[model samples]
Target: MTTWLLYGATGYTGKLIAQEAVERGMRPLLAGRSKEKVQPLAEELGLAFRIFELNSQTAEHLEDIDLVLHCAGPFEKTSKPMIHACLKAGVHYLDITGEISVFEYTHSLHEEALQKNIILCSGVGFDVIPTDCTALKLKQALPDAVELALGFDSDSGISPGTMKTMVEGLGGGNTVRKEGQLTDAAIGKHQRLIDFGRGKKSAMAIPWGDVATAYYTTGIPNISAWIPTPKAAIYAARLLNAASPLLSSEKVKQPLLKWVEQGVEGPNQEQRARSAAYIWGQAANADGVIKTCRINTANVYDLTVYGALEVTQRLLTGDYPSGSWTPAALFGPDLLESLPGSGRFEIDSFYPGNAN
Candidate 1:
């Protein structure tokens, strides 16, 4: 039987993934830095549990596991050690990280992973799974496209882990792909009225992982990622860009982190069931030909559970290419279509026909 380990099993999102795994009759070994938390959950799920800090010893625990579903963050700190362990143990690696730096770093290890014949995939969650696939679908609709714009509206509450990750990057501004290079852009640098199938909504450029992953997947030279935000928040982001020095300081960031700690772990089951996410993408060539696509899916957190487990299950079946890969690159855009309650549409345009 293919066995996997669930690191950071006690986290909010980690717990959700664990529950989904159990519901699907999967019994992943629960591992984390804390026995107090992981032990209870493991017992509840009737699975074995292990506790280990991310270090040289991590490989010892991976001896029999085929894959690791790393859910802990901020991945900027957690991913390196775990990745090193996975590579050493010859185990496939996956994570739910939206951090662009994390994606870039993981991609840099493609050769190492290929050498070991172990797949390394990140951003399997709400971060880029939907957006990355949508970007590829748009690229298919416009094969000669040189520029791409992606947008999403997450009508769901933020989890504590997600908030902490966002707080850690407050002063770094946003990121966008220009001429196929990842470059910093001012927060709120670009704004658009994206028609997310529901209606036109205000969206602003953000340092979403797709700014990096989309380019890697499609080879699009210019790309931007956006998220729907209220007008007031957009204005605040503009001002925050000017005050980045202060915002990025520990003195200011500490209180914000504390404030986030007081927030809920994440959305409740009711909220997740009722909420929804909308995504839009457009690819264009120099001649002004454009191809657009839209995706409507369940709530962000809910989709995270499905997306993460779906990828995990697929990895368990064991025939994936060995290298750092984007979700779309590994599974194709039709991967998104397999998710329940997910829908995608491509607009008919005067551009080239669909590549797929």
Candidate 2:
């Protein structure tokens, strides 16, 4: 049987994935930088475990591992090292990352991954799967699509790791793909009323991973992603944008990160069971033709568990193409519907009244 390793196996989302993986009868080697955390989980699950920080010796640890499902983040820091190690070791790489830089970086390694005959798939989680798939679906519906917009809203709580990643991204403000290039937009500069299957809500464009991945998935020249935001948070985002340097500083970020560490563990079981996430996307062509789609799924973290494992199970079969790929690029838009709690995509196409 093909075997794999689960790094960051003790994290909140990782623990859920680990437990579910065991319940599904797979014995992945549990791993993380901290033996204190990783070992206990391995013991509890009765699975093999390993401890190793991301470093030059990382590839040495993958000798017996066929694939790696990396749950560690902020992946902007953690992904490169593991990816380098995976490339060297000829092991397939997958991660639940939604970070734009990480996705672009991994995409840069596409040729190397293809050369090594190992798949480098990122954003396997809620990060981009639903939106990425939506982008593809929209593109398919309107083959001439030149523009894409995607937004998601959820009542789910954030994890400390995710919080830290967001903090680290404060310096980036907002980003969107414009005419095939990444363009920075000021925070709160791009707001839209998106109906994410739950009435129209005010959403602000953010530096979502789809600003990178959706372009790759759909070959659309323009793209943006948004999330519902209140007026107060929008004001704060604008202030943070002006204070980007402070947020980028370790001295300034440490305290906030520490608070997240102590106080934020992400949603509990009940929250995971009840919370749902909605994704909305649209594509437009020069002719003013529009295509739209929406997906409702389990909470982002819960979807991550299913999405990661779904990709993991498929990669284990050794049937997927070997190259860096977004989920939609690898599995088609249907992959989103395949998730355990995902609702079928609701799609519509029409010509705007303003169309010439």
Candidate 3:
């Protein structure tokens, strides 16, 4: 009986989640800014939908909704309004956002969410679920952990929304959680060879959402997030950092944004089926103890659809607590393995002792 809404239900990932919801026999009212896109999909799926822009009047639409799965993003721009509306409407808020700023913004409203008795959980997707869970599991393994490193590599092609988010991030440099605080760092400043159960692949630190969520989830003060990157992309990111100011300008960003809008939607069915994601995480303490773990899962996009629906179903069944939460924190570290095609975390190594 939990009435929920799926916003941005027309986007690539959004559509996937929406379709999966129906296939699971769950009905979530679909919503988006464009009626043309939202209505057609709703009609095709035989589901109800609403069209509304993010504005002062947004909460009015959530009046009857118990939860909102906000799939629209560039969450840096889209999240604030939806969060505000959710708070106003006393609706639990969930989103498939991997943006650090969005995580931090939602975390800032933790008290308000607790007061409203509604949960605000974000990154219920490939973005931070695998990484966040890995972080927590490692922390649980090494209780006194002070440093955390996380990385992932996925073969799934990018969606337009993801590409836009990356284009927008060109100017923000990169960030790491240092001494329990978010600190700016040069993009690709830190590199390491991580064996994500396959082989040693070169990874470079990037501003992943775990930089924000993992800190809250595991209380690890020093955190770094990474992704496998080619030497050329690393060099390009360095150059992009040097030209950060220009990239921040609308004049420079608009064309790139337009290109993304006109380009590929995302991977097709074949690509989704063919792709896979690998994640690696480590936690270490000053005492020289380290715990390393890794997981292999379905394509990032496919996991997003599964993760989002799983979270939605759980919340509807009264499975999580109220307040701002990372996906791992709300569902525990085994959440990733609970999904289809996502296996249990393989504790690859333990320094000086048993991981358990």
* lDDT per model vs. reference: 0.89, 0.90, 0.91
Q: What local lDDT score does residue 91 receive in model 3, on the 0 to 100 scale?
A: 95
Clashes of each: 0, 0, 0
Number of the top lDDT candidate: 3
Tens-digit lDDT string for candidate 1 (165-267): 9889989998899998999889887887888778887888988899889988999999998877778888888988889998889998899999988855788
TM agreement with the true structure for every prediction: 0.96, 0.97, 0.97
Looking at candidate 2, the ten consecutive residues that score lowest on lDDT are 347-356
Q: Which residue ranges in model 2 land beyond 4 Å of their true spot?
A: 353-356
RMSD each, Å = 2.5, 1.6, 1.7
Report the lDDT tens digits of candidate 2 across residue range 1-356.
68899998887878999999999998999999898898888999999999998999999999988999999998999999999999999999999999989999999999999999999999999988889988999988989999999988899988888998887775778899999999999988888788988998878999999999999998999999988998778878787778878778888778888887888888898988888998899998998888888889989998998999998998887498889999999999998899999999888778877533
- Give lDDT tens digits, candidate 3, residues 1-356: 67999999999999999989999899999999998899999999999999999998999999999999999999999999999999999999999999999999999999999999999999999988899999989988889999999988888899989998988886888899999999999987788788876888878898999999999999999999988887788878777777888888889888999999887689998999988899899988998887889989999999999998988888988656789999999999989999998988877555566554
* CA lDDT for candidate 1: 0.89
| Candidate 2 Cα lDDT to native | 0.90
Off by over 4 Å in 3: 352-356
Residue pairs clashing in model 2 are none
